[model samples]
Target: MQKLHKLLRMGDLAAFVGIVDDGGFAEAARRRGMSASTLSRSVTRLEEQLKVTLLRRTTRSIEITSEGAAVLAEAREILNRSETLKEIATSGQAPAGPLRVNAPVPFVLHVLAPRLAEFHANYPAIQLSIDMTDTLVDLIGSHADVAIRLGRLQDSEMLHRPIGRTAWKLVAAPDYLDRKGWPEALADLARLEQVRFAAPDHINTLRFIGMADPLEIPASVTANNGEAVRQLVLRGLGVARFSDFMIADDIRAGRLVELFSGQLDAEPLEISALYLTRVSGLRRLGVFLDWLDAIQVG
Candidate 1:
């Protein structure tokens, strides 16, 4: 047991992580700047020391057995904690590691991208990697430090902080309104041409205001992407529901006009930043969260 304990050191933990990340011994060895034979021997030694077969290896490929997967997960957690300790000991000021973030596509390009330069300038030692997608990502599984989510959060395990609110507006281009007239009531929405915002499987619902109840408008044009729906609206195809932040520029330029504004509710969609509560107070994560709060969006 003592020999096994000594063998399962930091280097073995790193090797276990590399195998899971790279998907094979050859790939993991390549990433670690070692030969494939060397990596295989190291893993074999680890299994022997533990007296457990952790991986199922064949001539063509290697797969982590159930035991191996559990071990790998524990190893990753240990490595992360160890690295955090090292950072705490070495760096006394500012964040100085990779910050992985996930955010909705439009928000990243339209909102976060513009402010990144300033963040980079302030924390020059920190490196930022952003994954932009509207799809919901598992923060722990993806190793993401932060995520910017729109609307209400359903994950009770996560820590959520409200950043801002986005109003949902029913808008139409001038030409479309000129042709189809205007929708005066909830019933009018059914009669008018509509463009549906089709989000991915998990995020495929739309909410509206007024009429003593919510209305679910059928789609004349259904798209999986928000940008696609926006383009169709720009072309004067139909009236669509969009976030206020998204159509702010068009409304200001008079390209799009809001319909039935008086009937709509004032509670805008709540936007929040989400992360694992345990890691929310980390130095690097806090720095980025503070930067996000300072941003002013209309």
Candidate 2:
């Protein structure tokens, strides 16, 4: 029988796989928050122990040998099984270890960030790594433990739980509307200056509940981020659509005014937490999801 314990180190296998997945030792080290030399040493040790030339390295790049490709496949399986074992071990234990979370910028700033301090206080052992961006991310490829998504979710094998919803409103600053005059009909929207959310697939139209055709509007200004669009509208630039969570206080304080409330019937954006089923039994994820459920989000 093979001496499994003495055959090779699990950490060395992981490092080799990381080096290949990240495309190089330096990048793997950077993403893993370790030094490049350490990863290089791990791969070197792995190669020596296996008696196989895993990678052919040049000054500029690396080429993986056939042996390396075979080893990589096995290493991925072993590492994944190791993670599943960890999940099983911690299923009933106190919530601990690292949790990677992904969310959009607006939700991160307006909803999640405010509650982070209290969450840390409650579960001091749980480490958090949060990545904030508006663009969608591949959860498994990005190694995210959970992703908080807005709007409709695409069809996927990942499991999701609804967190809450936020109403969308057509809004503008008081001074801007006062200067341009209030819109009397849906047709008036096309004539008004508008601040638009900048995206490649962004539509320059609004779809109402009972409308047959979407109403097209002109974009006076464009911003890639929701917060930037909010700022533009606040500065009396033009009328823009905003989620209630971003401007509820401003609406109540009269800094911004909601327009065509009776006419606009845009559906509320649904908030949800997405994760892989493999991690569904983890206590730390469970604790975090429970906290998300308890918190009130606009």
Best by TM-score: 2
Cα lDDT computed for each candidate against the true fold: 0.74, 0.81
Determine which window of 10 residues in candidate 1 has minimal summed lDDT: 201-210
Clashes of 2: 0
Expressed as tens digits, the lDDT of each residue in 214-276 for candidate 2 is: 777777899898888889999988888777888888899999988888566677888889986
lDDT digits (tens) for residues 166-258 of candidate 1: 877878899987787767666776666778667643222434453455555556687777767778988888877777878877899999998
What does the lDDT come to for candidate 2?
Answer: 0.81
Poorest 10 consecutive residues of model 2 by lDDT? 199-208
C-alpha lDDT of residue 168 in model 1:
72
Per-prediction TM-score: 0.79, 0.83
Cα lDDT over the full model 1: 0.74
